[model samples]
Target: MSVEPKMPKCWRKESKPHKFCPGCGHGLALKALGMAIDELGIQDKVVFGCDIGCSLLAWDFFDVDIVQTHHGRTTPVITGLKRANPDLIGIAYMGDGGGYAIGSQHLVNAATRNEKITAILVNNTNYGMTGGQMAPTTLPNQKTETSPYGRSIEETGYPTQGPEMVAAIARDEAYAARGTVANMRQLKGFFKKALQNQIDGNGFSFVEVLSTCPTNWRTDAKGTWKYLEEEMTKFFKVGEFKTPAAKGEQS
Candidate 1:
């Protein structure tokens, strides 16, 4: 007899065999998130909002209340939900394009305002759902549909340092971190901390996860791991950039 693989209780049972492309990192990221939710026991109080792009595929990935927003609008939608009902734990999930490009303004304003919401952005370096177009987080010298000749640093500048930007602008009580799908434990820890920060009524929490997109990257299994564990980590360092200071402690 075969035994089913263990899964997070908050994950939808019917959604097994998720819709993400093979070798894609979104599933791993969501798994870590689901585990965090289960461990925290806040499944009922959580409100999940996903943006356009590949991230939108997770609309029914969880058993919690979910909202699918337009491209880059997940942040505002989650913010509105949190403001309207402070008791709810709001989570905004999106891709690099949604968080760094079209929805950048919302991200900036939310961080500056210290919104009590958790924002998770998966950085796969390209617009995964939109034919692998060059995105704000696309690395220099990387090739994509729009950047077929390879990304030019002089023309496009460097990839967006999402966690760094959020940590720099958000208030002292806010939490910011960068995790990778390669390390599920660390990613889950970051997710737990971010959610706890919101549960404690702290300021904004943001986590950027380095993910893989083999279908768009045109890479095999080995190449996907190489890009995610080696190439991507070169530019995007993984670690906690900021965390809430202990009570009576200086920031």
Candidate 2:
């Protein structure tokens, strides 16, 4: 195995506040994460590394320790955190662009090496914090600031299927799943499996969450729900891609 970096101490202060917009999916994702850690009683053991975009807004969401990394670079930080502290539950929370585009190389390598970490990849479709830009996970022909005329197939192609991509490379012992926060009950189950993957000592668990970006999409909150439910779910199916049992071991 390759050498890993050391985990640092938790460094969140009470005065710091989360910067996410109201009704943003990132805030819900963070809430799920916090609930999972709290239920498992591992708040102190979680080391959060949030990448750029709305994900960075989660910097102060949790009461545990936290760290910020450059755009699309949370994978390396999480990798280092796991290697440094085997006991720590290292999580890399990042936006679609940060994960599938700028940080893809790191993501693939991390999965290949079976790095012991959990990555919560938020695919809000459009780039929210970056003025509604098109990301690698942007759906086919999705309109954005740069693609007012719609994304060109010859240039942009289709959005990357992240869970499928990781599952293709993951070892049998690893876990990969897709989930959505459109509803509360489903969200709880998804978050449970995500955190369980970490507790199981399984390597390289991934949860690709199909999220909403109402502000960027220039849609009302109700419209965001409709898109997430009617359209985005069609393109990005949500479910578990890998599991401990399928990995040739008891789950």
Candidate 3:
């Protein structure tokens, strides 16, 4: 017998029957985020900033104030919002394309500057909302709409490892980590920790969630889950790249 999952009261009941694809992983990531907010009782104090792509669909999903921003612009907007109102919890929800490609500079600068905000980057490898194109996070030699002959690392460079990149800065007090939607328990833990870091007035917290794009990948639910577990994890090593304790601060 299966049991119903406990949902967060922070979720909008009117947004039920979400618009994500059948095997998409965005739902799982969003659920974990929502539950984390609910657990921390910060539902009303949150300012969710969603970037272009599938992540923008979450603008109405949360009961908290949400704003949909242009492609690769969510981070700066959230950072500015947090700076303007330190009392508000700033969250940047974005897909791989928005987080790794055009917005990567903003991400790096925000981390280096120690912006007090939380960023959740859902990496589905390909650009799901935009015809499954080759995103910066796409695995090497992975076939996508733009990489029909498989991605050529020789020409395209390596996939963007977000957590590792952000964690490499020794002086920054940024908490960086990576998790997968396939692993709900671990994913939720990562989400909660990232949120708690912000609540504790930490500099910056980032969580990269390895997700699936079934509709874009042309895979069913089962196949998509398998890909996320076996294939995706091979390229994106899941772990806590850095924590607040590493910076000698309690998270």
Candidate 4:
């Protein structure tokens, strides 16, 4: 007899053998999120919204209701849902391009307003769905279809520090963290906390996950792990940047 792989109860079994490319990190990120939802027992109250990039592939990844939005619009859509029905646990999922580039304004405004929603952004460094174009989070020396000669820092500037930005702008009750797919347990912990923050009626919550895209990266298994565990961590610095203060403590 063969032992079956354990999956999150909120995950759709029919969607098993997901559509993400081999070695893609979105699956791992989503798995962690699914586990968080299962542990929190808020599957019914969760309203998931995914952006138009590779993140859109997760439209049916979960058994919960999901809204697929245009590129960079997931944040506003989720914000609207949460505002209309404060009981809903709104989660906006998107890629770096969607969150940092096209959707950056929505992200910034939401953080400034301290919207009661959780935003999960997967930073793979490139526009994976759009033929590996250089994105806002692409490293300085990284090369992509649009940056074939390697990204120039002088022209492009550094990668977007997403968690840092969110933590700096969001109110004291907000939560911000940077997690990686290499560490599933830690990533899931961050996801759970972010969701719990929303459940507690806290302000905006954001988690940026460093993920892998071997197909767009043109890397083998060894290279993929090297980039994800070693290279990416150097710049991303996975950790919680900010969290809600204790009950009676100063923020």
Q: List the residue pairs that clash in candidate 2.
A: 5-84, 6-84, 172-247
* TM-score for each candidate, following the candidate numbering: 0.99, 0.89, 0.94, 0.98
> TM-score for model 2?
0.89
Best by lDDT: 1
What tens-digit string does per-residue lDDT give for candidate 1 at 25-108? 999999999999999999999999999999999999999999999999999999999999999999999999999999999999
Candidate 2 stretches greater than 4 Å from native? 1-18, 246-251
Give the candidate order by descending lDDT.
1, 4, 3, 2
Count of backbone clashes for each model? 0, 3, 0, 0
Rank by TM-score, descending?
A: 1, 4, 3, 2
Cα lDDT, all candidates:
0.97, 0.80, 0.88, 0.95
What lDDT does candidate 4 reach at residue 223? 98
Candidate 3 RMSD computed on C-alpha atoms after optimal superposition onto the true structure: 2.3
lDDT string, candidate 2, 1-251, tens digits = 97533221222344234466666787566656666676677777888899988888777766777898999999999899899888998989999999999999999999999898988899988788879998887777778998998888788888889999899998876778888877645665666676777778877888888888888887898888898888898788878788767455566
- Give the Å error, residue 8, model 1: 0.7
Report the Cα lDDT for residue 167, model 4: 92
